[model samples]
Target chain A: MRTRTLYMGMIAALIVVVGLVGCSKKPPPGEIIPPPEVTPSEMPQTERVPGDETAPPGSAAEDAALQIEDVFYEFDKYALTARARDTLTRDADVLLANPGMRLLIEGHCDERGTREYNLALADRRARASRDFLVAYGIDASRLETISYGEERPFVLGSTESAWSKNRRAHFVVRQ
Target chain B: MKPIVHRFSIREPEQARAHGLRAGPFTVALLFWAGVLTVALLFCADAAAPEIDLHGTVVKRTLYRVPIVVEDFAIEASPGERNDPLFFSGGERPEDLLVQDLRFSDAFQVVRRRQGSFDPAGEPPRDIDGALVEQPIQARVVGRMEWDDERLRLKAELIDQGTGNRILDREVAINREGELARPDRWAIHRLSDEITRYLTGTPGCAATRIAFLRESRSGKELFLVDWDGYEEQAVTGLGTILVSPAWHPSGERIAFTSYHRGAPVLVALDLESRRLATLSTAPTPAAAVYSPNGKRVAFSTTAEGDAELYVARADGSHARRLTFHPDIDTAPCWSPSGERLVFTSDRCGRPQLFLIDADGSNLQQLTFSGEWNDSPDWSPAGSRIVHVCQIGGRFELALIDVQGFGWRRLTVGGGCENPRWAPDGRHVVFALTQAGVRNLWILDADSGNLRQLTASPDHSYNPGWSRPARERIRASG
Candidate 1:
């Protein structure tokens, strides 16, 4: 029994080393330094990145610089537009190429209306994007959803330009 | 899914105005304050009756405001404690807070006069000499401060200038345990509330606490501040996003939404024990409010696909769904009777207020003029409902009767939202943003007067006014 436990520890260590080597081989361009390994206890400091347990040690930096595009929506709308559908189509291709990757889809809204209503609207936006990807042959278990309502914004202004940028569905690679 | 039902006819903006005119102003005032005397008696339960007959003016919605003046507090420290730093420092004076508390009630127009210091152990003679030329002062308040047994005691008196009758005489004391260098705010607030009750027929909101959300470096968290926006303290330190705080009727627990575990969930925090118990783990739980009786809770969640309303026991068992709309239907606020709820829905193309029975029947629409209306809070007085109405692309505070009689805007130029009525049902605390700065302000809907509550650089919103806790009366019988 003790021998089996020791063998399990060795296998986990070998898997971590292999994952780190594969991540360092083709680092995304403009990413010279790798991100420090984040433990579960240090999750509060990096709030935007909620989950990083199953991914490689330095995958947080790579997740931040992912090549996937975000899907945008109009005011008080979650129905996919032609442009949003096209963007999600390309995002689906990226997911198909990386079979072992999992994604966390974040839905955000502009700073208008009541906070609770904005939360419900943003949830619909994230679910709408996830459903689109699932229809394009992506595994349903690979996608998870969360909505920030109007609390977190990409831009900080009340103008139309800033508001348009804020109403979007952002993607982060979890594994 | 239950089909959408419309019980009342959808009237145009012009037709609604005509209906309001036919109903008349006296009926509107009568319907608005029909429950005022009952609520006032519950707050002010003393043996002696009101000194003056001001209920007629209050019940009829007259524009008559009592003119009053507050005199500087006299210092009568014991001989050995004369030079104590507590009485000599230039901090927040008890008299200044007393004046602010009285002015915020909107029942009095107050002027502060600091005449040359008075004799510590003597009483000043009374005279009817007019102070202001525009309006003669009709009443005045005087206070005396001293030390006894390592505690601060303040003796306050209210004098009616019209008849020179001493209406109220009260004494408030505070311990020396917390912040001995300055006068105790709780004592001064108690004195202010006592005086307001004798002068006006209604009690003041000075002694209550407001629970709200304040922005921090990490994220938004729950905070508790006095009704006058002093002594701000954080109640939750999870360093994550929190929203929509609702106080239990007993003022012992607060239910709000917390995102500590990466998804929004409803939880209740007991102020006395500091224990948090999860109420609902449904998908996207946004707004949760306690019923008037505190036995049940009504909230909005998207557990079954779209945003819907649910009613559950206080311990979050025996859950029952209330609404089944495909479009967004959320933000459920209960009536004082706890048998019905009013929520915001977008099924009518734009967000508007909708009323439904707790058993999911007899659905009716409430507002007809605004392009968007949301966040409806039923008044504790059981007559009016206050909400946010969008007029010309700006959000402003508006009020409507429960029976859909009168619809009027309380503020102009917009930028107002999340309005919650005080226990007195006359004042409203809401968030107002002007020129990129957001702060909380209390509005007197009856008189159109406003007083600023918070002025922090960080934004503060989602104010939840707690019911005034019952304490022993300190006024003369």
Candidate 2:
């Protein structure tokens, strides 16, 4: 009975110590960037802000038209989830709407795996998005791909909430 | 023994303090007891099993550190020449560096004069019966340095105390040019390695170079430094993402993945010519490693929408796919014999190490314990594979034999990654993160001693230890 009590006490102490260490090691919260604009046809168009005076004509309109949502993946996985496929389907609609727009599909991963493996995984994630769009009738020539690996993280933390957002295929409409 | 225990106690509590936690003495004592219990259990479990000799095992073995008396080099001036102050007023003295190298080698422990004083340059005492005096020392090293015309010359000798025989005599000269025109400490490094080789039969790692990636605000770039982490030289400034820097067998070229042209590509850089060549055939290549013979290259590419292992000639011709997995298969490292490769793949549902023949036959899984394992580098002896294993949600360096019988974690406190073996096969250089700063560290495989090789503020990782220059010279000579 005494041994059991000591074991429980030790376990509780270990948990407390580990909790403190883990809390202290949390990466400082980074600048929170808004998620990519998901411009579904059913949604109301957002009002253009008043800072459009310095922009070229029609470029702002093109940027708004090319706004597509980013598709995310699980840890160390490149296979698109069902939600990811739906997002890419909507992304394909935006690509089809803007015929002159060329999309740069940027694959990114969280800071977890080895750099080399992460780079390759990121490439696969980007290519998966591109392949899905092409299969959805978007022209193959309209999309290009690049992998930032873990070098660029969308959200800078090791938590699952941040990692889920970081592991994604980000879209940038090239001019 | 007391010092060792004190070091452990201090290091553990200090690491806890670095986390901003107020670990009181009671907490520290509890933690130490917990650690001791855990280690005792592990040791008991591991000791119960008989040794397995499938490949070179990281199994615990008895360490025999040779006791040697090392003397400060006697500085000698050339006949009729002034003792130049220029030679003395340089960076690190040769004798100090030799002592540091000997200590770092872990094969010899320098006996302090307090233990038993002896004249290293003087002859040993002989009894009246023509027998040598009794001493605990096994060997002695003595050296002298003098200024030759345009170079500084160092002559060293290693004498065996037991047999009273001279084991080695060597001389090294360094030219006085480049970087303040100082006598290069590399001459001392060469002598240390020579002495170590003559005594231990295996070359020391002092005179080697490690290629690693240094991250900056712009991007990650390749940098080269000595084995002792001096003379930092930037090899590439592409201002783009670079990873997996690999040294060719000849130690004259480096291949790495670069995102210079908007896509990941395998690029080779010639150190002497400052030339870069892209292996254009590989689509989105990463983790390019040269074969043991330097005639072939194995790399991972995404030519078919999914990453797969591919092999080609060293010049990037006659490319052929070596794996047909739909799952992600990448980071292929060549075995010592170049007949097979050990790589990471997710075909097993999670990332695990898999070994396959060069012709893509007889594929087998090598690790099944870790949740994730990747970036395996085969040791030069073809016996062990060191890789990054995820334990407790943190990456640590782990070693496994070729036959997949043993699994051993080499580091603790996590944040260890990208392990590569030195040419000596007894030392491993890997990246370790502490207090949020990543630096390069070396692990003595035999002694399990960890030493930081680089402590830069910027992140440094992906270390590739090159063949020691002395070995190349000896091979050619």
Candidate 3:
């Protein structure tokens, strides 16, 4: 009987201890448990800003009505083809019609070469176009040349048709 | 009660002996007290004993990733302020930027707590056992963003989970005017680099910037971007073709080939003063690189009717030809000691890598395996040369030892070229094309880990990595 009483007392003490531990005070008010890091949200889409010159200005549509054709070059060659010279002759005629107009000849290349080398080649192409216009009785001061290298393609696909269109010197009119 | 006492009472020694009993209550009480004393002594001994020191043997692994936890950022707005204007609408948050930087570092495995969880404001827990529950977080980073009247402040703390000690705490600030003038990414980059240094014992690449060519409708202009691809800005707005941008060792200037005057010429731009100075007066000058000491420059020019390498003072004076080969020699990269150069030449009937003394004495071919190899850049440690090699009509990056042995191809893709080594000598950043779209990619030299650094829809090529400006200053000092 004495042993049974001791066992009952120990069981009661354990129950009280467990109850006390469970009823412990809560954390202080206004304390926040920091959230986990590394939430994988969707990546923001890159949007072109309004004054970014990723493409030709909207005014180029009006200039395209002038019927001045862009000049093309052969693959890996900056020298103008015979057909390219013929196109430049007509562009020179357009420049002659408007003496007050200044022309920006943007040299471009197809996406098939190294960037730095293509840059040099495009520069040569632009200068070639400028030289042809200067020799065709157009004022040299009215012509400025820039090379876009393989950047700013006229078409997006990697086809021969697209590459042929991209490998050209486009003329833009500036007043 | 009297009957129970009598029943429980112990007999005397003579009565116990007769009854075959061992002892009475006195002896029993004594033995119980002795047992209690022994247990108490054991408890005392355990409390006063010193802890055992354990030394573990380390096993070398091919790759070891440090586990780190990034806590959600806290915003502390100033009086009357509602939000931070520095962050773009729907763009990356401050914590996002930090996480991106850590991920690209390839040194840490970042863990994030559940979304919308609140962090208790105050000091972090004082012991690893106190902070961790289920995850194996080795380190934790907590950040707070404070915005007040045109000024933005970012405070970050790096805590070591093992010791529960705060390893680093840094605060960065940027003004509204500065944000409008330049992207505020630099401040975050500086903090990220500090955190990396605290964790890895070496600085991170966040402070390094890359200069590449961006195609504008008018021309291809040189542009600059931070290593994380933020702060995209034009370095030169000359409305002409520019290429081959090479950063000076000091990171204060850049030399590139520009066609502003109708022909290619080497031009140097001072980043701070925004001054443009022509470096080459020749008709065609391209591919300029600075010596390791930043005191001299070497470039290729066609003034002699063929492309040949030339060396000049940093100020573009005292120019002299470095190579007299009849074949074309371009893309001259100076050795780290500035005693020799590795350049591309076609003297062997095709473009190949050749090494020559700084004064143009001992000419030796460095590559003979590839039919074409060009754009050779010497490693910062002067132990290897990385160049673009043409194999099966596709361009790939190849690394060759300085002693001309152990040639290794680094890129699995055929459209990788123009590999430039990082200042740490363990990473190389180069241009890679996939599906005809060119972007910049970085590769780890030892582990062969590859990561795409840029993901712009437009083409980004000709990347030039900068040395950490802080490290450069420390070294010079």
Candidate 4:
């Protein structure tokens, strides 16, 4: 009778050990194993985050409160007109309202000139807008400029309407 | 055949006296007969033998297209081997590319075979028989393609039909086959170049490449494609605007202007290592071109407020401004001798091409008739310049001699820009835009024959042609 009791106890111990082994096979919740090491040459030089730099900052309500319209220019001209000045006035007011906010002025051109020349024209257009903002009491250091140079068109067409819409200084909010 | 007899008579006076015979009439008749026989024999020998003229004639020859026949390549497969997918899909075969190259080269008039038009199911004939030779096939090309596991072997031969002699024979191996793959195209291109070399004294541009700007989703990226527009690949993924790719003399690196850092900068990218090196850190640097020796670079920069031309070492050191005009000056191209530069400047109130020395001394205007002219590329031989001219509100390609003469228009309809010369100096590749679509086209500079090369959905422009890679390597070594 004592041997029979000891065999039952041994069987129970074996069952407990087996149960422990099976439970240990799987990892715990939210646990992760590291991946293999990769050589430096195999890694990408730049981690690209598409459209992140151009994305609008802050909550939806705050973004809605900031209204900075794009300024348009004449064909083959980078100088700002009266209407462009009015738009920059409003953009400068928005920048002044939020001290922590920064602005990226994107200069674009129509598809009517050489690519290299258009880039230079776009730079002048972006500087025109930025210069206007700086004159309207906005800090110069808070502004950054880039020229897309007929690469990204607001409207895809060759008509005057489309080209006029494409030749503009687009405003983007950054922090 | 003719035979003659010689006669002789004993006409001595002593002999006649001893025989007691008169020698007047008989001796005269024998002498006449002997003389006649000797003249007859001389005449016969002279008529039978060939004559030789001591003086020679000089003949002038002109260049003409060589006529050749490019037969459809045959596929050799075992009984149980599966046919190559490219053979039966009605797609571009290797021979088709070879024929296109031969035609585009303007060096040959390719004649086609009438019978056995590329049958993938039948066995390839061992030799080109008389029936196919009866056509206008002056020279014939016979090829055999076989498959072993994953590898493909191609054996091509160029035969002179008149002599039945093989002018060229080559074997090529390709490890993979796909629509986007390049090995098959490369192998066929190499073979085409060999055929061209065999027929003409100079090698063809089939093995060269062209670098251009292809519009992508994010921006314009630098892309490289074979001369035939077979292998198209993006070289720069900076996700920013890039343009004006200039191939180094070694054909291993390219210098281009990129906007990766929110401003224009000149960047050089090593093709093999896929590494990028910044050559210019100016606010707006564009139109970078390598010198003939590949030791210096000439580019246009806007860092000094107005756009001006600048020169620096190939590593972007010792930068010196070349143009000091307030107006825009850009699009710098080096002369073949690397002693002069042709650039587009607006100092005269409108954009026009100007010539300057390497040290920026000889500032002379090159173009005057056009209201706007830009993108001037000096010929490889340094005798002419091809640039884009705006006429009637449409940009067209125009060629001008180095002496500022022979201003001939090359393109007729549609807008064409950015004309680049092949290393052979006989062909020009430019971008043609029509109805808001842009494609690359090649033009035979001599015959003015136009052929479309690339049909990409995105716009392609600013083509830069490279020298033959093998020749460049040999030259560098």
Give the per-residue Cα lDDT of candidate 1 at B130. 31
Scored by CA lDDT, what does every candidate get?
A: 0.76, 0.76, 0.70, 0.74
Question: DockQ scores for all the models shown?
Answer: 0.11, 0.16, 0.03, 0.05
Candidate 4 residue pairs in backbone clash = none
Q: Would you estimate the TM-scores of all the predictions?
A: 0.75, 0.77, 0.61, 0.68
How well does chain B match by TM-score in each candidate?
A: 0.77, 0.80, 0.75, 0.73
Q: List the candidate 4 regions with Cα displacement exceeding 4 Å.
A: A1-69, A80-103, A129-143, A173-175, B1-64, B70-96, B113-184, B194-203, B473-477
Give interface RMSD for all predictions: 26.9, 14.8, 22.4, 34.1
Interface RMSD of 1: 26.9
Cα lDDT of candidate 4 equals 0.74
Estimate, for each residue in B349-459, the C-alpha lDDT of model 1 and write its tens digit: 788999999888988988776788999999987779999888888888888998988887887757787899998888999888754656778888887767678765568
Q: Please identify which of the two predictions, 1 or 2, would achieve the higher DockQ against the true structure.
A: 2
* TM-score on 0 to 1 scale for chain A of candidate 1: 0.66
On lDDT, the stronger of 2 and 4 is 2
The CAPRI-style docking tier of model 2 reads incorrect
TM-score of 3: 0.61
Instruction: Give the per-residue lDDT digits (tens) of candidate 3, residues B226-327.
Output: 777666666665666677899999888989887665545677887776667879877457788999999999987657645678899998899899988765
In candidate 4 chain B, where is summed lDDT lowest over 10 consecutive residues? B51-60
Worst 10 residues of 1 chain A by lDDT: A31-40
Alpha-carbon RMSD, candidate 1: 21.1
Question: Which candidate gets the maximum TM-score versus the true structure?
Answer: 2
